[model samples]
Target: MSPVFAALKERHPNLRPQFYMSDCADAFWNSWRAVFEVEGVTRLYCIWHVWRAWNAHIMKVVDDARRSQLREMLLKLTQASTPHAFYSLYNTYAEIMNSKEYMLKDQNKKPRSLANTSQKNMSSTTVANCGLVSAAWAQISLPTCT
Candidate 1:
């Protein structure tokens, strides 16, 4: 990957991407950063992968209706047209996760907060990267690459 990036740079000295999207892989990110260290590149994770990971957590919701609501909220967060909308939806989702209304029972029948479970499964870095991707998309109108 570094060699390929180096070749591209060799061919086009002015080539600098404003955004680079990947599947949230550590190797890809490390390579990208190594190649574009001084460039202001907004790293983005694939939205499909992000949604798939979050869906696993959403499926754990015991209440069907609440689960559906959470699914919709997550979808909205990913599909938000603007950074402001994304942030708003993200806050609402976080609030719901932290609230007592979103609870699951342990084997002992004691309630456990979904917030803890979610935070355990999904790191804050993933959420922050998603926001960066959303913001980059909102600010640019780049042609889609195959």
Candidate 2:
């Protein structure tokens, strides 16, 4: 991939690329992180893939009866109008996880690992770098007449 990209860059110095990929593996993300940083490329995560990962994670931790409702709320966060709103919802979710009712049901199970996975996956760096909160909504503001 690097050799191919290097050749292209040599042929077209003005050319810039945007790379979109799934969060299927940490290796995949790490491999491109350095390449994108050095080449000044925009790295975007596929929303469909993101939803797949989110759904998988939620299914493991959330109750079956409430999974559908919780999944809907999780999806809505992706459509948040602002980063603050996104984080606010995230914080609310965190608080819910810590509540007495939640703790009793959790029963010292695997919720901690679940929370860690969600936190790392939703890190500020990932959100900002992928422009999930801003670039997404910004597209709607473009004038259709233009």
Candidate 3:
């Protein structure tokens, strides 16, 4: 265990550790997974980084109106409490993008289409950690005695 955890455990013996890691290269994830596996620590990718990646994708969209609409939907998807709700919003966005009514082009001025399976290939991380820390952090009344 790290010294930080040791100190915190001294005060709160029942505390549990939840590790949040950004999705990294295969080699880095392999090494990290091995170490954390032995320690029995649960790990998840930070949702903040996931949201940033989504924003980057939105910026690549050529049409201002479509970009704004997608951004709005992205915010709602991130805020969804259940996986069903998230996917519902995601599918809605995908349908709009793929529809003939919503003619769109890429930043390169070439025509583009939204592929249903393409989103899976765009990011390295799938599982996102959103509420893992917030509730715990709110309850901790740590003294900033340093």
**Counted clashes in each candidate structure:** 0, 0, 0
lDDT of 2: 0.47
**Residue 7's lDDT in candidate 3:** 61
Give RMSD (Å) of candidate 3 vs. truth: 14.6
Per-model lDDT: 0.53, 0.47, 0.42
lDDT of 3 by residue, 1-146 (tens): 35544565567766545543444223433554443342644343344444554566556543676777766765675555555665576567556756723422422221111111224442322323133122222222211111
Report the CA-based lDDT of candidate 3 relative to the real structure: 0.42
Q: Candidate 3, residue 131: CA error in Å?
A: 11
Instruction: Compose the digit string of candidate 1's lDDT tens values, residues 1-146.
Output: 88877777778877677556666455766776677654676565565555564565456543667777877875675555555775677677657766734533331221111111233444554445355445433332212221
Q: Which ten residues in a row have the lowest lDDT in candidate 1?
A: 107-116
- Candidates 1 and 3 compared by lDDT, better number: 1
Deviation from native of the Cα of residue 41 in model 1, angstroms = 0.9
Clashing pairs in 2: none
Our tally of clashes for model 1 stands at 0
CA lDDT of 2 in candidate 1?
81
Pick the TM-score winner.
1
TM-score between model 3 and native: 0.45
